[model samples]
Target: MQRVPKAALLGAGALAIVLVVVVVLLVAGGGSDNDNKNAAAPRGGATQKQGNGDQGDAKPDASAKPSLTGSALPNGDLSNTRDMKGPITSGNVKDLQAGWSLALGQESQSQYGSYAASPVVVKGVIYSQDLASNVSAIDLKTGEVLWSQQYASPDQGPNGVNVGGGRVYGATADSAFALDQKTGKEIWSRKLIRNAGEGIDMAPGYHGGLVYVSTVPGNNGKFYGGGTKGILWALDAKSGKKVWSFDTAPTEKWSKKNEDINLGGGLWHTPAFDGSGGMYFGVGNPGPFPGTDDHPWGSSRPGKNLYTNSLVKLDAKTGKLKWYYQVIPHDIYDWDFQNPPILTKVKGRPAVVESGKVGYVVAVDRATGKLLWKRAVGKHNGHDKDPFYASKGQYSKLRLNEEIYPGRLGGVIAPMSTDGKYVFAPVVNNSVTFTGQDKDQATDGQTSTGELVAVDLDTGKIKWKVEFPTPAFGATTVTNDVVFATTFDGVLHAVSAKTGKTLWEQQLPASTNTGVTVHDNTVIAPAGLAAGQGQTPAIVTYTLNGK
Candidate 1:
């Protein structure tokens, strides 16, 4: 697959939140081989007998009936976002097929680029948002085009798509779009700000009856207001009406004028819901803009920016700020804390684990937003001599730059898969560059090479790390015994979840940006260029056969 030419026209904020520090303890645990060995073992004699003589000797339990309809879909209830509901279980595994699986739209050319938004699966239907402010619905099983509807602003970049409450929600560069899930018809559209220049980078998160979206304004192609001021909106899911809005820009006069000061700390990734009415999300970089004196430095700004690069928790129902943990105070390296925050129980403790551009994997208390543990999963590089203050008094110097393992874009960018026993992180290699004066420099460039890692969720210890030949830019999926990942190089790979060994591999025409989704025995990959060039972008489906 070929990389698209750099489009310098518009700004879409970086991905992930700031890197927070956590203390991790290494411990020994069960191995992948041990798990596999037990799975393949024969069942007890009584269970075996029941299976063999099943005919008329046993009656099926009423509660065990196969479900023909989709289970109750998840509402974007902050408290319940982490709870597993419906047919999508965290532990169930299924075989996947791979081909020109599903087609949503004709390839279209645009100035910004092709499509970068990932699609969503809801109740067997696939929902996608493209460059234009529109969302399309397709049949997951048949690849049939169901319907497509356009939102209000065509120029708005619909970066993320989501489905809930029998409604489809899309987050555009300028606003939010809500559509009828069944008809692909627009229900209502709301614009937080008009043509703010910098496109909002996050997908909309739905919880309870509210939709959460973020935006960045005052981006004049310079570094000052070019940085986000951290604007978040909560809207009524059914009506596209604003419920509440929060701003992270500092209220002090001196701080607002310093371009190096925290100007914009907008949301870059979709907020995660805890299913219990709580929401979790991250913020992005501080700015002087792209080319200006607003660069983040000790002398440039005197104090830490509130919520500039931090993990924030909000009441899902009321849009109330609960607690926050700053990952990087007064961030200078363009490290945005906007990655996915996954909620899982680690070592029996309910925790939120997240990755960031700073190359760290951190776990925090989901309810209280308290730090539990953190580890350097990738390489870190930057000025480590800067003095800053945390909740405690003052620290003279901290290690800001350590050539860590994973760079930005995460050791894993996609949401992790877990069986409640282990977490699967798809690894990617990345690099960074810094320029400017010795004290203040502009940083850019991150390259990724892909790999897969299994970690003990409880201890934050690596059970195994397996590298891929090509870098993966898409998402990942897992079932029973296997894990799946697709690369920008137009390839799909299947590996033993237990052994970290490759089970199958297949090549496609273009980069796979949407990741792999499984339906029954087939695997689906959405491949093609966002600009509608080179290889024809189409969905490929695959299935495995007995040798």
Candidate 2:
């Protein structure tokens, strides 16, 4: 997917999950399409906050806040976000009723099932992409398809579109293209990928005049075995010509000489803008991960993987690195810092906040790239230090399977939402155990649970955390008072942003690996994907029934 505005930073989420997961095979062999950023390992569960020296050009604009109409959602470039203060409050959310249902395609026909893209509502039209990367325009009020751009794209998700500069932008398996916003006609297309093992799946971010699209190391629903490096590109929005490109992979000293040991970084979501021509994104993880049998504990890939699993700030016009703060150093467990870099003002200071599968949400000075604060969400098992110990051959079999919090299918696997003061995250707590630091197979403990956490943007302290029965995926959407999240059980939960209490919940027709959109009195939920035996993949829209 691809456009933010004229210039925008990239945005979140990870993993190609199913109704059930066998992570061992997915990690040690053919990477079951899955996924994050790690720079430096924070010594403890949290990092301290600080002021910065770079009083850069970033200015706060509430009007420029990500919304559905006009611009995109705060995180909605293939993920989700919103600007309108939602009307469904904790008190009134219980009155919501199913309003309209739209099916993108049949579960059998699509590989990734139904919709993975968050619906982008601009003006009165809703722009959405399906599992096949098909773009559609619908009437926001009546739920009618206005135009459809047909495609045969693979179900490599988080794929979606960005509507700006009179064109809608999206990508297929190997190419990126632009479409007329009104007529749905193809304008300019660029071939961005050369192989199935590595391609583009994230929604492109747009701002000022350039569009940002990055290459991911995945082949449809599977990951590249090895040697695939990711690239971030700033393309000319008008001609689809590359303005600049940045290599996400850093040149590292291979632990095994002359071996193909590098599987580099990419993006899971679109980027966010810093108002001051700076584009921000959470970089993906490095691979040949955890370790192969011989290269135990990722010994073949050692040291801090610069730019990988880190928050990279770049000059939107030049693509030059401004600053970066790594969350996990030499990440072995796919703890990607892959959430949308949400921009907000804390105590009059501009800050960028992000969260990844590492289950840690971090905030940094927007201009200085200095750590403001960091807090751990969900669960932790100290497995984050395994790569360090094992990388140095201090391997201990006693530590095997002992650490599994934020496991293979766990942590913050979806995009997060923010309403200035607090950030809302959808976290999956599926515990996964590995045979050892040197082993390839990982076993799922199957203790999969979920939570919605509210973190104070300024202090990095968790304000509240609401638990759920099953894992939640996709993006977290919030109005003024209520936070909206979707669970793997296909239930949409409306939680109190202030209290972390579930105010209302509704079950859909099927399971979900997607997000929700809230506009005015309506909450649009994409209840498509992994439909039950009798259910059809449908996008369910709920309206306040009696309010």
Candidate 3:
């Protein structure tokens, strides 16, 4: 949840040659006409308006429903959402008390904290994984362990499992695997990495009869050590067989000519399905980001990297490209568009919404990929405009050591959640100082201050925002009228969804950078960074103190 071992501040990027663009045109409904124009980001600032900006009906698409199905949180089509169909109410949320806690063991320790993903619940079992990609099943009522499958393979962070078709799906550092939902024994594990530079860390997704996983650029403990990489793969869920693979950065082969000097492309969060055979996911950044002393200003990798920092949709059944809208072009900072895309309706039209390290929440037409509206959230200190300047060939004036809002670590590092009417995004205001290009790194040793910004789905405007002292790394989870957010320091807060008023708060056993989940009458959070800060790793649960 904090910075990973390698230079990847965030996971997610875009670029293209003819092959990629032709592949791109297959999804061309979403891309801009050319490189420079795309990099300029059309409506690139805060409180911006785009094609038909959706001020139309001023209501959420009524067909959308909050997921009670345990696939994280379902969107209109569903990725993750704050709204829940659970019985937890604002009145009783304030009455919650500690239910149970399960302390983790040595096997759970990882460089980056484990337990970073929100657990999935099916029947009465909770399915979760840690940083090393170890998964376990725990009883929903009692905190007793049902089954544990330990890979102990050190993963970066944000990896978890999905349950569907009567099986649990997940990934280790280099493979996609499935487990018997009842026994926790391995059903099938398939190796999916293309090169040593690629690994898997995202929670796998399920649709139709297939389990889907994506490749991220990482190896050993280093991040982005390969050429433009991230690829998305869909596998037959029943047999664990490969189905289709889509490269997030198609132009890397054509542009870099197979050189491994620069790294690009990857998906950080899981994906949201449109339910009509369409799937949506965000893509990550290009590198050596901001460039080294020699390739300062990203000179080596030119042109708007197509799929990186973009929101894309594909024909889930065929892995065919549908539409792609590059969110940031030629990104110089660690702006990843890799948050799970929430499929919902805005202005009564089917729209897909996403936000990431770029700190802006955006909504677009689900079918045509047309921009609907964009709202800048958190503290945006003009760094977003750098891409536009880079588009104009004036990016040489990049500042060094200046306190940029939404720094490499700033922005929305985790996925956001949504109610039918509003999207709740976790905002991290961490900053990074770009050392002169002589060194290929930016430095920042500070913890972050964050907040939750609520954006109206129809108007694309800020409805309300609540601040936090610690970084709110977890994705927001909402019940009927309550919004639950977990700060990295382990404090979980319950707020009124309508007024942004604090409803309840509880201190967890240890530090956590993951998300919170609401099921039935209980609230569950997993914490396992058991190192310092007077804390220990454990799965913590809470319920109303008294009936």
Among these predictions, the greatest lDDT belongs to 3
- Listed in order, each prediction's TM-score against the native is 0.74, 0.85, 0.87
Stronger candidate by TM-score (1 vs 2): 2
Query: How would you encode candidate 2's per-residue C-alpha lDDT over 311-371 as one tens digit per residue?
Result: 9888889999999989877777666677667777666687777777778888888889898
User: Which residue runs does candidate 1 get wrong by more than 4 Å?
Assistant: 1-96, 102-113, 151-158, 217-228, 248-254, 259-262, 289-291, 294-301, 381-412, 437-448, 530-534, 543-547
Tens-digit lDDT track of model 1 for 241-302 = 88898775452432545543435567655676654667787665555422233332433444
TM for candidate 3 is 0.87
Q: Count the backbone clashes (under 3 Å) in each candidate.
A: 69, 28, 19
Q: What's the ranking of the predictions by lDDT, best on top?
A: 3, 2, 1
Summarize candidate 3's per-residue lDDT along 1-547 as a digit string, tens digits. 1243111225532111111211211111111111111110111112211111111111123245634634332221244454556778888887777776776666765666556676777666677777777787777777666667878787776777877666778889899998777667798999987787677778887777777788887644556664637888899988998999998877564256535666677777677776577888998877666766656666666778777889998998898999999888887776888788887789788888888888889999998999999888888776777876765568565777776777666688777777778888888777667776522345552656779888999999999999987667677887788988877666778898898999888776666677777777888877655434346667778777722
For residue 357, what is the lDDT in candidate 2?
75
Show where candidate 2 strays beyond 4 Å: 1-19, 22-68, 73-83, 107-110, 251-259, 391-393, 397-399, 436-440
Distance from true location, Cα of 523 in model 1, Å: 2.8
Candidate 3 runs further than 4 Å off: 1-9, 12-62, 66-79, 251-254, 438-440, 445-447
lDDT of 3 at 101: 72
